[model samples]
Target chain A: MPDAIDFWFSTGSTYTYLTVSRLEQVEAATGMRFNWRPFSVRAIMRVQNNSPFANKPVKMGYMWRDIERRAGLYGLPVKVPAPYPLQEFDRANRVALLGLEEGWGKPYIVASYRRWFVDGQEPGMEPNLSASLREVGQDPARVVGQAQSDRIGGVYGAATDEARRLGVFGSPTFAVKGELFWGDDRLDDAICWLKHGRLVA
Target chain B: MPDAIDFWFSTGSTYTYLTVSRLEQVEAATGMRFNWRPFSVRAIMRVQNNSPFANKPVKMGYMWRDIERRAGLYGLPVKVPAPYPLQEFDRANRVALLGLEEGWGKPYIVASYRRWFVDGQEPGMEPNLSASLREVGQDPARVVGQAQSDRIGGVYGAATDEARRLGVFGSPTFAVKGELFWGDDRLDDAICWLKHGRLVA
Candidate 1:
């Protein structure tokens, strides 16, 4: 069996969107089977005692510039979303959970990221998401409805609890077997582990 | 007078240690005086709705790993300090405040970072700090005593409040004329801005 690549992500994360764009190509080239796992960003933050943008204006300013630079480097268009945190992740993540159940998680993640990052559409923005889903031949309303079901809720909760149990504390995180790789920047290292069964020293 | 570069920092931040070591060379090369300003990481996180560590085991795992990589990249010897966060920053920060007053903040920052990143000492670990101070011909006990004064405390508070007002959320952040740049990775870009007055498109 191919090594399982567990992808833990958040819909509102820009880095997650970036990683989603390239992960498939890496997986195909490396012969790794991806296991898409979506979880709540808020639930994980509670355990770490760290607020994401804590009191450094200079740093936040740098992030906008750096993300744009990285996006340009990756040939992706970047747009700063309104209402900064994009609180609509509730519905987006719920739908993603349903996608996981149907084994459509990988495609959903890619499409969602493309819509948000490449197309500059917000994932929580219904019209954009619906259109994007339809383009991918998915029934938007049905997928969304299924995302809100108790079954999907249970999946979301389980993924979140598992994240805590596994000591996950950030987005764009990946795991190979049991070894973990954090940040969008570490994707190559994750692939290395999957391919070699040990981290590069 | 040259445009002042705001050095946004936190008392307990590690990346700041690296930046401090190089600030003088950067300033001499670019001809800008860094306005050393300290801020609280806690306050910035509240506004961004981001916890420092977002909930993914891979992220937590990668942080330590990434730091090690960065230490190697910078040619700094690093040891994970005891008790992780090193809670005695109040005293250490007070000393920094005094150093700021004495116009020795730059050296103090460099020495402190050397002690931690190069010497593998914990922040606020007295023996290490004292030795570091002695290396710079500073009397550690006298400096520590001075750090406790009302004036230094006032400056520390003001710097923290200033950081919140400027929308700073993390460390080793750089600001030039109120333009904020977050993260240690952005130091080069910040220097570019210091020299060119804007980012190159």
Candidate 2:
């Protein structure tokens, strides 16, 4: 087992927003540090041929409603700034990758989600993405230039491929030892499992 | 929404086993009474053309492992009495309907899960189903006879149809007012939502 939980997340995953926003609080509460991994869920879902909420209006509707309720419970807001299930997440995710190497990655991810879901700014688009990067004190031009580099692409693709190999069917997965716990709902369990050895007899 | 939470569940659903086993304990802890409605998730999933774990070995693997961990968390056991994703749940569900009408429904459901997941007994099988009915102090032959009647079939079908109409995409969902919360993970959120209106501004 790893010393830290590997939090596999996606740039466009609605629930990943919750995990990013709550990361600091959860760390403080549980005394556990997470290895924040930014990966391409769209590429993963493509391989699986599964789009859980795409073209499924009822499930999509439930997802939005569930997010709103969860955000409320977590003391957050959902402005729903831009259209969801957004397609162009590569830029945002790459920028997140760049931010990570420079120690601004976590806050950049949180700021991006706040822009997309809380602050009425479209994510992965011009101006909004740059503004989110700047909020965490990174020079947008410098960070984004590096983010769009071939080097960033290599690491980003590697993370997604690794996620697939781990049998991670969805975003916001927690992986430790040989066990994979998918979805934000299992976050607590993952933490406990990491600490208590599955709590089974 | 309704005065009490409508706990829509399927007898064969793996997660529903957790909900059924936890029902009384949850009610006692939260002081919330549940309106248990026995419905066919197989019928609902068929209408959606979805079998989330069918032919999806990875997800199915995660589910059983997750259930075992949860059973451990809740101090229960998964004896794996019979093959999972059992196909013949209609007989067991019909008996549940009959049990409910005679005020033994809740315990019957719990006993049935205990038999299926805890004890080494196959659900919907001859001796097991009869033994479950008798555990609730009901006449196995008489209850199963009435359960097999046209009226039970009618109500059973109606509940399944109602679940479909309610946009219930999965089993072990909690429906409150006009909102629907899916999965056992949302069970706590559903209760909190019922008690305190969403907890958001």
Candidate 3:
């Protein structure tokens, strides 16, 4: 059991947007360190033959409303983009991996979420990607070059593999002491689990 | 928006078991009445082309662990029965409707959950269903007979229809003010929403 929280998320997840936006606040409040990890949620859901948005439209309607309401609760802005499930996560995820190595991971992730969810910008689309990196104080040209490198693909793939081994079938999963807590709703319990361990008899 | 909570659940769902066990506490604390609803999760899942335990063994593994952890947190005992996802909820649901009419719905639900999740008994199984109804002080023979009636079948089907109309795609869904909050985890938020309303800018 390590004294850190493994925060696993995908760039395209709406619930991940919630956790990403509020993670800084949670860290400050709990005095905890986060091991930020980015993975491909599509790959993960593939293993289970599941797609988040592949089911009932009625349920999806409620979910869209729920996310809006939750964002309002957190004072975060959101606007679902025109062309949805934009699997344009590869470049963004690669840059995020590079950002993690460069010590600007959190800000980069927050910017990426804001770009897609709040500003309705398509991920992996130019100007957006470069601008997000530069906004976080990273050199866009250099970071983007590194992000597009063959090496980053291997690294990203391994991270996705690691997520599978850790039993992370969903995005915004928080792992502490080898226990996995899935979904944004489990964020508070994940933090508490880190601070005091699992509730046991 | 009505001043009540619509509590929906599938007897065979593990998450629903969690909420069913704790609903009494919530009602006591919130001073709210629940429209205790019982419906077939399988019937609901079919509309979405999903099976609750379909092709997602890894996710299912995590879910089992999650339920156990939550059970401990709530000081509730649980033992996953052999051959799970017992879909014999029809008779039990019908009896539950009768129990609600008799003003013993909560106790009956609690007893039903205990039988399946704690005592490791199959749902709608002879001795178990009879014992649960009797424990809640209902006449077992009469309730069982009524539960198997064609009229009760119609009633149960209507409730399932109502759940779908209300956009209840999952178990342990809580509806207040026409807002559907799915999952046992959202029970607290649902209660708070009833108390304070949605947060808005």
Candidate 4:
């Protein structure tokens, strides 16, 4: 079997920012391929009823500080978006699906993550999404128009279902074989698993 | 100021079991004091409406596997109790308060955690609670009786309120100064923060 890891995230996920920032380095170090998959985190949260950011004020305060602290440690710049979560991830994910298929997923996804997080821009907005597409050398008009089609919507829905099937409750989930490792911290463990099979005592 | 970290947990918390398992080594290494405080995690979860174990089936499955995986990595054995989350943590917390006050807090708390998670025993039961107290060199009847008093109940209530005021949302939260590091994964970070203060880079 080929050595591959599934990289699952949503455009709006905070922890995903941390994972995406250093993902290329991890890939290079492990000499492994990453299946960059984007899905709707809001849908998963809605089903789970666990949006601590919006519900728990105390956790929300700590999370912002934790993100900044972690980002600094990783040597990456992060600025929390103006309106957090930017619930309209459908438009951005639609284009992301196309990008993943077209071999520009890495750059397109990273740039869009920067747009939403580092630059504090809204990915759901046309100018923001189109700019990311343009940077990845894709025709902005063609990609944007194609993303709005029913076919892309169907593909996006299927991807969310796949995430649920794969037991992904949170973002930045890394999966090797059938074992799932959730959150940014587990990236190292997942990479280790990829490099050297299951952990044995 | 004394170099101390607030060790926060509920008797029924799974992740807290992981932290309590290795807490002594961390204390020995850092030469830091831990203020072991037990509170009702169920009450906090109710306020947040984020109980994935009970609400989200997928998450609950993943959590068990994750906990077991982490426990193995930490060189600690874990056995899931008959009924997870043991809703009645009042009995355990009451006696735990007395344990903390009497300075046998570390052994008392670790024994109680082993009873619940490793031995698959209930903490709220008289037989189980009494056994833990006796193992810690305390008179079972006296400690049990003292734990049932109105004063201890009041003290336990105040501790939960203090946890809320300190912005603690989850079990196994290690707090130093005003920074809150939540979850078992954060224990290392909290210890590092204690040993080296805050990260500036």
Tell me, by DockQ, which candidate is best. 3
Model 3 alpha-carbon miss at residue B177, Å:
1.0
Instruction: Give a tens-digit lDDT track for model 1, residues A82-192.
Output: 234665787788877777677776677677767776566678566667876776678987887788889888888988999878767778778776767777766776777
A best-first ranking of the candidates according to their lDDT comes to 2, 3, 4, 1
- Candidate 1, residue A22: how far the Cα is off, in Å: 4.9
Which lDDT values do the candidates have, in the order given? Answer: 0.69, 0.81, 0.81, 0.80
Q: How far is candidate 3 from the true structure (C-alpha RMSD, Å)?
A: 2.3
Tens digits of lDDT, candidate 4, A1-201: 377789988877778888887889877877877888888877887887756478666677778888877887788888853447675677878888888888887788888888877777777676677788889899988988888889888989899999988888888899897899999988877877777665543
lDDT of 2 by residue, B126-171 (tens): 6678888888898887887888899999999999989888988888
Model 4: chain B TM-score relative to the native chain B: 0.91
Candidate 1's displacement at residue B163, Å, is 3.7
Q: Is candidate 1 or candidate 2 better by lDDT?
A: 2
**Model 2 chain B — which ten-residue stretch has the worst lDDT?**
B79-88
Every model's DockQ? 0.19, 0.43, 0.59, 0.49
Q: In DockQ, how does model 2 score against the reference complex?
A: 0.43
The DockQ ranking, best first, is 3, 4, 2, 1
**Residue B61, model 1: Cα distance from true site in angstroms:** 7.5
User: lDDT at A85 for candidate 2?
Assistant: 72
What is the lDDT for A141 in model 4? 83
lDDT of 3: 0.81
| Model 3 lDDT tens row, A39-131 | 887888876886766655766677778888888889889885323676577887888888888899878889877888877776666657777
TM-score for all predictions? 0.71, 0.90, 0.94, 0.93
Name the regions of candidate 3 deviating beyond 4 angstroms: A81-83, A139-141, B81-83, B199-201
